[model samples]
Target: MSDNLLSRFLRYVRIDTQSDETSKTFPSTPGQLVLLEMLKQELTELGAADVQMTRPGYVMASISANTRKARVPTVAFLAHVDTAPDCSGKNVKPIVHRKYDGRVVKFPDKPGLTLDPATSPELRTAIGKDIVTASGTTLLGSDDKSGVAVIMTLVERLLRETKRKHGLIRVCFTPDEEIGRGVDKLDLRMLGADVAYTLDGGPPGEICWETFSGDAAEVIVDGITTHTMEAKAKGMVNAAYLAGKLLAALPRERCAPETTDGRDGFIHPIHVEGRTERSVVKFLLRDFELNGLADKGKILRGLCRGLQASEPRARVRCKLRKQYRNMAYWLRKDMRPVELAREAFVAAGLKPYDHVIRGGTDGSRLTELGLPTPNLFCGEHNAHGPLEWVAVQDMESAVSACAQLAELWERKS
Candidate 1:
């Protein structure tokens, strides 16, 4: 299928692949497997060898080495198939804007919501490019779907042009990345790749190798309940009030998402559920360094202890669990991967910007598993929200970069 990135991306996003965090299943959602199965069948039709899909919604396919060189290293390209659980991925309606002029863009479905260049500065970067977005009611799923199109397009080009020499290329599409369980059950050793790059970043010409070290914390508060007739006379504690008190007592100066940016970490309360007798507040803690994350965890624990001291009759517990670590700092033993990606971007006729991402990707977990996978740009902007968009030109540039990366490695010998 020689479909354009726009067509391919639209086709992929038409399906609802939102992952579930509460599900105990490996993939967390059956919809993810539908997309993964589609990719598996399409890869097989594309003549990719050793195509296989795992029960957890990981699809792996390989393109054999075309070069005669025996020393070529196996490289992989990856993206996720699932969309974020934060937004509705059901019945997404993507709108295309051709030859964008610098103006205030409005979503057709929403009369009041506007995407201004001043508020979303990233829109400024796509002034002259063809942009794609969803209606105001839903996210476009371009976060990684555009990434899927980029890799798929590159595969078609490499297969058609027999003269293009390259080493073995492995393509992987994972699920539940938005929920942070994309690679939880991945079989890295079986997949067999020396190095990899995830097409899962924002803007064009970006090479991200560093990501935040992350942990999820849950605060469980238990309270006493009394009859309404004797509420004041009998001992009664409101757990929801206790949870809110602890949330308000959290350090907002240096530990809040709004107060931090560009490598500084934050403790963000993403979800809260409570009753009069019980309440649970979930937080995501992030830091570039492990010690910083540990400090945040300590602060949370200290808050719980203080709450206990103030309310001896109530039971409050704070538990911080590891999600993923900073991949670049923990596993990258060489600079060649970073340099090669830069070279790839330059070959695609664009300057590359390498930065420490404020968030995590599937590459973060894969790198932690010893593959040293870095992230490549796919033009995703304002991801996981109704304001998400992707530039067509930027996606084409990413596809060119992927192809150039293969050619560069072949020429490296």
Candidate 2:
């Protein structure tokens, strides 16, 4: 089973499915559709029923219960297929460290690249375990692929074990999650699951039930263009200078990513493009509380207004768009799923730690769609980068935990 998990994970990561954030298409990349078809075929071969790969690349499958129980609530497991666009996902080559010696492991070909324990203290816990990593070139794509492997392995285990009783289990692989548009084309009505769990978190035995309310802010500054040789104080109000002023005017100590923590709001500038004639600044705003989110937007607008006043010759425009809300609102009302997950982890001989996610997940958006979904860990660390790695023991534990979760759900609902 361990070999199967690693083999499947390695196979899935070899396919380049990097999502395009700039694409107007549903799946974002055509490569994601290819993987979706592969998963659909594999599920069919594993004897899963109702296997369907939608046009926009949403793969759905179901496993019927072997028990005679009636009125059992259906459960679903979800994971995304596309990897982060932060790094290249092409031609990923994974290397396995067998029985690690609690020392820093370096790439054989790249002497300068090494997984330093001093930099990442978390390596101590994974000592004496098998770890899969990239070749210090491309990301390993374990963020959600590990979750995919967990669900697939659990389903295969259930099918092989004849006596294991479970209700209908639905599984889905979504696309474009890295760009925050994963569930935009999701058909929840057809999914028909009473509740679902997204196996997309990091670290083993970690569960996340809360996330930040997110939004994007764009500020455009238009100015008159004048030749640099003929530039004067009032003749040309440099839009780039105006953009810099606006960025500086934002709460320096308070609204920064490095200084913020739990429940703290932040305004992160993601993109900046400017010239003397025109400039545009793109930022992402995140807050755990609704009122705080509104206040952050107001602060951003106030900065733009102040910049307009300082540079009267330049025109300033601000646009704020709400993305997704905090999942805590739904999790608070229904704590049964959280309790069930905790019990499942204990049953699988692992310690469960519950925390609020620093970033958003597909579970955040699924909760608002009336699913009340929460995120479970798949043991991948340093995601979206070339240094990504996942322990073999942790992956096995995740598969066991997923199987136990299905049984726990059967007993409760």
How many clashes show up per model? 0, 0
Per-candidate Cα lDDT values, in order, are 0.88, 0.89
Model 2, position 229: C-alpha lDDT score: 80
Put down candidate 2 lDDT per residue, 314-367, tens digits, no spaces.
999999987888999988998988999999999999899987887799989999
lDDT of 1 by residue, 1-413 (tens): 32366788888998899989889987888888888888898889889989998765689999899999998889999999999989999999998888888688899888899888999998988888889889899989998899998998888888888788889999999988998998888899867888899999988888998999999999999998888688778888889989999999999898899999987898899889998799999999999999999999998989999998889989999988889889878556786878888998998898999877998998888888788899999888999999899888888888889889988888896
In model 1, the Cα lDDT at residue 343 comes to 95
Runs off by more than 4 Å, candidate 1: 1-3
